[model samples]
Target: MMVVSTMTSPDTVLDFAHAVALGLSDRPRWLPSRFLYDERGSELFEQICELPEYYLTRAEAAILRRVAPVLRRKTGPVTLVELGSGSSVKTDLLLAAYAEEGASVRYVPVDVSASILRTAAERIEETFPSVNVSGLHGEFEQALPLLEDYGPVMLLFLGSSIGNFNQAESLAFWRRVAAALPRGGWVLLGVDLAKPAAVLEAAYNDAAGVTAAFTRNLFARMNRELGAGLDLAAIGHEARWNPEWQRIEIGARFHRRQTLHVEPLGRRFTIEPGELVMTEISRKYSLPNLTEYLRCFGLATAHTATDDQRRFAVLLLQKGE
Candidate 1:
């Protein structure tokens, strides 16, 4: 069974305009990282994961492969609910593990992109004919609440996506997730660990320039969706590692001062020369910090697996029994 719920409410558009107006009005100018996943942006991100310098995807995949057997045992016969389940390429291992263990597995994948969600759902059903796949098309927060009705679900928030949120946001998100799960429910969280600054920076600003393309694609998205006139050539990608924040920051910097107009918002803005519009931040964390963060939300780490490089970690967290 395949199910998808798009934001039929007009509020989705209003929310976009409100966020854009608010963010662009702020000093330093910014856009939420969530806006970076339109169809083209999603495709670019898939390419980015394959880049030699982008180790996060591969490292997380390695950890998932190693831990899938354990996850199969822990999760038993339950639905696997995944948030931001893009491509879902790495998830093949987990699904395979459940099937091999003779678990009656049902898969629910949630994502904002209908095309991506549908494509992934089709692939999952076709490849693993025995497993049932249900695709939910919506934001994670909205989709999470629906999980409460399911039985013994295991949530998959992979790709270090939690790193997109700050400390407070992360806590609030996990609290909501914890509240949505039944007892013995699990959350498989993929997190990028704090490593050498050079390594982290390289992951975002890859030598192959795919990451750069991905960054610039945001402007293209704005132009396409918001009817914004943006000179793509004038916008360049810049990624820097902030030691104080312990995160890698990526932004679109203007080459020259210019005025931009968005038809949807009916607003115009000016960009100063060399000014940056912050696009995304990938926060790295330590095990102790993450453990405490999860603990605050009533989640305890049941098991953790890391790649041989130890550059990434996947934690199997469960609400207190």
Candidate 2:
């Protein structure tokens, strides 16, 4: 089900290719979080949204619904552009605000999964025929330039996908996003606030084993795409919260010793009897920390709101006009 090819793009420069080759040159053989949403991964994540312990989606949606009116007022004509825009269901809540404002609206959803993008865009067209839905099939870091064509865009980096990047990576990403959008362009982001250790763990390590399956699917993807002999049963899902880092790390742990030979870039890594193949990290943030972080990158805070009891926040940050 996975297709393999050598496609070049802004993000796939030689360095990027070399980095990816070296990064995946590990025993368990890993796939990046961005690849986590390949059709199956996307569906699994959708299921994650409803899990009782996964309070993030519900909480962030609550905040957005409450603040989007005010957010729309400032970022009017709120040309909605969401990065990693899988399905675009949650986004409808905010898009409705733009529609209600009688503002001419355009919705651009960017993602790497062509299947997911095609299906999402089609469904969106059905629900809101007047809404212009464009699909960009690319990763966020590389896809920012594609956004130029749609600028004056109020970008959406929703659903705590921000967690996947580290602080330095985040700053670089924000800088790029800010540069793509001129002054007055808005970025509405959903961030998982720092919370108790147990709560964070439970959400990712769900009872139904959905998250686990989601993690293991990476191996399935690698084996299918890169000719890597990675056995899903040999790996287990691990999610842990790091307070100091204010983030959650998700990885696939190899239980029994097994070496995987990845053929994509001709590399291999020894599989220790038990080792974790780090795949994703989701960072939590506080209001002050996030505000200062974005400000350091030249983006100014336009508005901020949170769910009752501060479970999570959806912030509207803008490039200074």
Cα lDDT computed for each candidate against the true fold:
0.84, 0.77
Worst 10 residues of 1 by lDDT: 2-11
Residue pairs with clashing backbones, model 2: 163-282, 163-283
Error of 2 at 8 (Å): 6.2
lDDT (Cα, tens digit) per residue for candidate 1, span 1-321:
655567444226556666777878999788888877777878888999999998989999988888898888776777888999999999999999987745557888888767777888888888887788888777888887888777888999999899888777777787788788877789999999999988888888888898889888878877776767888999989999888988888899999876776677789888988999999888999999889878877889999888998899999998888
TM-score of predicted structure 2? 0.91
**Model 2 misplaced stretches (Cα beyond 4 Å):** 1-20, 26-31, 101-103
- For residue 128, model 1's alpha carbon misses the true position, in angstroms, by 0.4
User: Per-residue alpha-carbon lDDT of model 2 for 1-321, expressed as tens digits?
Assistant: 112121235233343334446666644445467767677888888898889989999998888878867876787675787888887888888778887734557887888766777878887777765677777777776667656677677889889888888777787887788777866777888888998999999999999999998888767866776667877788999999988888898998889887676565677766776788887888888889789878876788888888997978888887887
Those runs of model 1 whose alpha carbons end farther than 4 Å from true positions after fitting are 7-13
Error of 1 at 101 (Å): 5.9
Task: Judging by TM-score against the true structure, name the best candidate.
Answer: 1
What TM-score, over all chains together, does every model reach?
0.95, 0.91
